[model samples]
Structure formats: C-alpha cells, structure tokens
Target: MKKTLPAYLGISFVWFSAHFGGGFASGRQIVAFFLNHQWTSLFMPAFSMLIMGLTFYFSMVIAAKFNTYDYSTWSKKVYGNLAPVMAPVFEIMFNALLVLVTAVAFATGGSTLAKAFGTPYMLNTVVLAAVIFVLTIYGADLVRKSATVVSLILIACIFIIYVPNIIYFFPKIIHNFAAVKSGEIVTGTQNSFLDTIWWAAKYGALQCCAIGAYIVHAQACPDKASLKKAAIVGFFINTVVMYLSYFGILAFVDQGVLKEAVPSLFVVMNGVGGAWMTVLISLCIVIGAVSTGVALVYGTTNRLANFFGRNMSEEERAAKRKIHCISSSAMLVIACWMVAQLGLIPLIGKGYGNIGWVSLLLLTVPILLRGLGLWRFAEDVPGKVAAE
Candidate 1:
C-alpha cells in the first residue's frame, strides 16, 4: 500500500514533539528565548516550524540520494569521515538527557500525582520509569505506535481550543508583540525572537533524538524521491501543529506565570483552563511524557546497534539490537531515577535548552560540507570515481 499523507504527518509531528518536548509543548525553552516579555515568543515558533518544514524537505532529498540504512553512511559518503560521527556521537549523550527528562517527568508528574493521589512525585516517577523501561524493551513498533497515538492526543488537545480561536489569537499576539516593540505594555523581548534563534542552536541535547523519526522515515522510505515527498508532507504537518500549539497555549496564559517554572512550558500549560480543559491537557501531557520517554530509549538503542554492526553477522547484529534495547532502557530508567532524586527542572532548561540549536546546525553542516568536500578533494584521488 502506498504511504498515506496522514501516516507521514503523524510521524513528523511525533518526532518533533519527541525531540522538542520541553520547548514546544509549553513554549518553555524556545518560546521564552524568543518571546521573552511580550509577543516575540508568540510569533517565532510559527516561523521556526516553517524552517523545520524546510529541513524536513531537505532531509528527504539527502536521504534518498544516499539510500543508506543509517545516516552515518550518508554522512561518510558525503563528508568522508566527519559527517558519519555527527548523529551517533550525539545519541551517546542520552545518559545525561535521560536523567534530566526523568527528573522533570517525575517532578511535574509528582504534582499531578499529588493532586490525584496525595503521593510524592519521586515515587510516581520511579513507577512511571519502570513501566516505560519495560515497554521500550519489548519492541520498537510498540513505542513508535505509542508515540503517534499520544502525539495525536496532544495535537487534538491544542487544536480543540486553538483552531477555532486562531483568528482572534493572532491579532492579540501581534498587538502584544507590537506593543513590546514600541515599549507599550512591556511585552516581547527587545530582541527576543533573534535570541531564540541564536539560543535554539545550542539546545539540542534536551531534544537530541527528537529528529530520530526523520531518520527512521528516511531510512525506511522506498526511494530517495519518495523520501523527499514524505519530508515535505511531514514538515508542513509539524509546523502547523507547532503554530497551533504556540498560539493556543498563549491564549490562556501570560508571561509572569510562565516565568515561575524558569523555562518550563508545561508549568504555563498547567494553568491553561478550567477543570475540564486542565484535566484534558494534563492527561495529554502524561501520555506525551510516556510517548517521548519511549522514543528516546528506542532511538538510542537503534543508533547504538547500527554503530557497532560492522563486526557482527546479520543474526548476531539482530540479537545485539535486542540487547541494546533492553539494556539501554534499564540504564536510562536508573539514570532518570537518579536525576529525580536530585531534582531536574532548572538543569534541563539551562543546559539542555542550549544544546538543541547546536544539533540543528551540526546536523546540516555535514550534508553541506561532505558534498563540497568531495568535490574539492576529487582531484587528489588515484582515479575519478562516481559519487556514492
């Protein structure tokens, strides 16, 4: 069966959410960096999502051209050796990021647990991690399916409220940003949008594998041409989702309250409505947290298995993959528990938020450089050979 647009769209949105959860969900990381006081943050995620759309388009172009199982070969073929290392090196950093996320999930999840059960958040985190770890070890299909399902719930929750109000929200955000620009209501950062773009460069660690879905899509695509098509469709779907999510949350929230979390968008979201809306969003978030957690563990597992596959037989390689999945999940859960024990919100914001931008920049550079590098170095080779 031909791949449907909805399938690709769902994949793209899930990946973006999986990668940029802390930022995109509540505008915690990117929103704050870009919007700051008034309206700047309000407009930029919309634009950034558009850029993401382009990145998605290009990813397909590059992937199909290379036709490789792992992007490392794509990079190596293009850049010699440098590009091969970009993605995998980053994947290894999961140990640190997992701890951070586990902490936030527990910290925030704790409050929800408390209201719901009068329980400590730390205890809830351990329970959640145990479940996530086990499910992730079982298989990739399970986690991938879970991510899509949870992401849909998230998109629905945002749209249920925002889509109808878009015509209204845009004008207010624009007015607020205008006022901030003119020093009218002390809104939007003086140069908040610019700051967000600059800051997004270094913010990838928190969201490192958020783009794993892109890689997965690229690898599994039937051909390079089909991959580009997938990327194009995927990009728009994701951007639209981000745009709706950005404005939707802002409609019910203000900057001062958002600052309380010191870079958490969910904290802002916690106040996005009355009892029903609150319950709806909160439920979506819990599911989202689970979906993302599962994605992280799975992405890390596959990348590791591929990285070490050269020495193993096909059967050995497949067996190794299972070990990677199971062991990594357990290790990550342990790390999360450790972070939860120490507390993790502020650390994630300050540290992980910065690395995200770097990843974006790093990801594309090899593609550009490797192609150019090969061109420049072509003359030095013993004989001219066609490109891979």
Candidate 2:
C-alpha cells in the first residue's frame, strides 16, 4: 500500500498550493517576513524547511496510525482529556481566522484584477468564490488534483518572473547585498535575526492548523517510511518556492520597489518582460489564491461535518456533509466579502501575526513533544477510538 513517487508529488503539490496563499504569491509575506531583514532573509528557507517538514511528518504519522483524519479526533489523541475543552476553542479560532485570511486573499486577487483590466471588484470576488465553491463541493480528490495542476503552472510562472531577473540583476544584487542593513521595520515592528527565526518558525507551525485536513486526507502512503518520504519531498518543493520568492523580492530591494503592497507584482512590472508577463504572473497569483481559498473552505467544512455527523448513520452523514458544504461555502463567501473590506495589510498583520504565534504553543509544541518520544499514547488508545 506504499504510495509511489508521483503520489507523493501530487500530495506535496496540494499541500504547497494550500499553504502558499495570496500573501505568499503576492510577495507580501516574503517582504514582511524575510526580505525586510536584508541579508538575514537568506536563512528563512532552511528554518522553514525544518519546522514545516517535521510538522507534516508527525501530523501524517499521527493521522495514519490513529485513523483520526479530522482535527477533533486528532486533538483528542494529542491533548487527551483537554480535547473536549480545546476542540471548540481551537476550531472556532482556527477556522474563523483561516476564513478571514482567505477572504482577504480573494479580495486582494480581485483588486489585482481590477487594477489589471478595469474589472469590477465585486465581479472578480464572485467569480473567485464560485470557482472555489464548485471545486470544494467535489471534495478532496478533486481539490488535490486541481491543486497539483495549478501548482505546476504557478511554479512555472514564478520562474518566468524571477529567474531571468535574478540572472540579469545578479551583479547589482551582489553589490547591494552587503550594503543593506538590518533594523528595517516590517509590519510596524523591527525584527532582529532571532526575531526573524522566531517568525519563520511560528509561521511554519501555524501552517499545521491550516494544512491539517489536507495532511490527513493525503494518507496515500500506508507506511511510516513512505509517509516520511512524502513529507520530505513536500518540504523540498515548499522550500524551493520560498527561496525563489524571497530572492526574487530581494533581487530588487535596492530599487525601493519592495515598499509596494504587492512587491512581486511591482518586480514583474519593472524587471520581467513587462505587460504580457505581468498578466501571466497576475493570473498565477489569482490561481494561487483560489487554490488556497478552496483548501481552507473545504477543510473547514469537512471539520464541521465530521464534528456534527460523529454519531449519524452513514447515509445521514453523507447527506449532512452535502448540506454543510453548501451552507458553509455560501456563508464563507459572504463573510469573506465583508471582512475583506478591512483591507489586505491589516488582515495579514493583525490576523496571521497573532494567531500564528498562538498555534506554535497549541499545536506545534504538543506535536513536537510526541514526535520526540517525550510523550506517549496508551497502546489501546487507537483501538478505543476506532471502536468508538
């Protein structure tokens, strides 16, 4: 039952698509978290790779071993008696924040389109939400396959935007690299090297909650060894994307263009092949946002359905899941439209920055403890849950 290399690649692509939302694709996350730090930005990829790789490996191992693919059951295994108390709190906070972030991504993508082609923001939002809603309703397999296809195109577009610039701007970037200094503030706060490390680690950990459902659903690898390979492969893919994005932004920092809201777009507008390339990169950004939006919405609905349908008959459960998906998607689209009115920068700073740090303690710490063998589950634990 071991998954083949292609299976792992497909799962990894889904994970990458889900995790790399509008913030990342727009270069805002890179500018705020890494590029603002000057030369220290170079260290983020390794730190992110370590934290995210371990998180994925352990989460998948737990999912496969315990047959607890939903967050509620997974929390029970991790937190024991605290599961009842933590489940609702974590669920509300995690899903709400994810929805808010995703909504902002959609809004940003819409606004980007509006700027590009004079399209109406409302129309763009409707089209984006509709696409995600339809894709999610088809469920995880479709989401995974759609994400893989989108991710491949996304990677290609990113290289087209960044690689040539990195080559052409090589000397200028090198000359400006050491001249750049630390102490540049990002998101209204200054970050030292240690702060950057903390931010990277926390961001990676926060992703645990966001990607939990996908990791659970991607249990194609039946054995620990194969699962580990999938996680490693996923990590590499993620790290490469991060590296390219970070350096792509860093390559043009001396131009002062990083000050823009969408630094990657600014870079493409200035450095890449211009109008046509801008349109292509813009399409890539919208696709990335859509991929992330679908994943979050689907994951949130799946969690809700599993929680409410826990004791239902199989037929009833199936019916309830359909209802939950439709209702939740509709509600999410409306709520996201409203919240996105608050704008993109505030959402990323206020929403992700605070919630991300909290997840480090709630999700990452416990999972790391278990992975390190410092914590143990009872031998009968899996059987007890399975029997229930």
Which candidate comes out best when scored by lDDT? 2
Off by over 4 Å in 1: 1-7, 20-23, 37-43, 56-79, 83-103, 163-175, 192-197, 200-209, 249-255, 262-273, 306-310, 319-324, 368-388
How far does residue 279 in candidate 1 sit from its true spot (Å)?
1.2
Instruction: For residues 162-222, write the lDDT of model 2, one tens digit per residue.
Output: 8888888888666666556533323323457788788777778767767555655645554
The root-mean-square deviation over C-alpha atoms between each candidate and the true structure, in angstroms, is 4.9, 3.4
**Model 1 worst lDDT window (10 residues):** 379-388
User: For this target, which candidate reaches the highest TM-score against the unseen true structure?
Assistant: 2
Residue 238 in model 2: shift from native, Å? 1.2
Backbone clash count, each prediction separately: 25, 0
> What's the residue-level lDDT of 2 in candidate 1?
25
Can you give the TM-score per candidate against the true fold?
0.76, 0.90
For residues 1-388, could you state the per-residue lDDT of candidate 1 as single tens digits?
Answer: 1243334444555465564343345455545544454454555554555445445544444545545434445444444444446545644444455556656665555555555567777677777787678767866445545666666677787676456555555666566445556675543355555565554334422243244434545544445345445556555655677666555544434445345442223433344344565565455555556666666656555555576676888999887877766776676667766776776566766775545555556554443343334343442244322131
Cα deviation at 319, candidate 2, in Å, is 5.3
Span of ten consecutive residues with least summed lDDT in model 2: 379-388
lDDT of 2 at 372: 73
